[model samples]
Target: MPSYTCSTCEREFSHCASLQNHVKVHDNAVVDRALQKISEER
Candidate 1:
């Protein structure tokens, strides 16, 4: 069986859709952190 692996977290998923969703979660988290940093800087 083939598995999708996350580059950022080294997690594995059984399907591409699950991997994509997982990556989006990480992307959102990074965006949230950046927004928080900007807010802190102000």
Candidate 2:
């Protein structure tokens, strides 16, 4: 079986779909943090 690895955190997933979803979670968190910072600076 093949495995997928996350580039940002070095986490491993057994399935590609799981890895994709996990990455999206990280991406969303990043976006949320950026939005918060912009709001604070305004």
Worst 10 residues of 1 by lDDT: 20-29
Residue 31, candidate 2: Cα error in Å is 0.6
**Could you give candidate 2's per-residue lDDT for residues 1-42 as a string of tens digits?**
999999999999999999999999899999999999999999
Q: Assess every candidate by TM-score.
A: 0.92, 0.86
lDDT of 1 by residue, 1-42 (tens): 899999999999999999998999899999999999999999
Off by over 4 Å in 1: none
TM-score, prediction 1: 0.92
- lDDT against the true structure, each candidate: 0.96, 0.96
Can you give the lDDT of residue 15 in candidate 1? 98
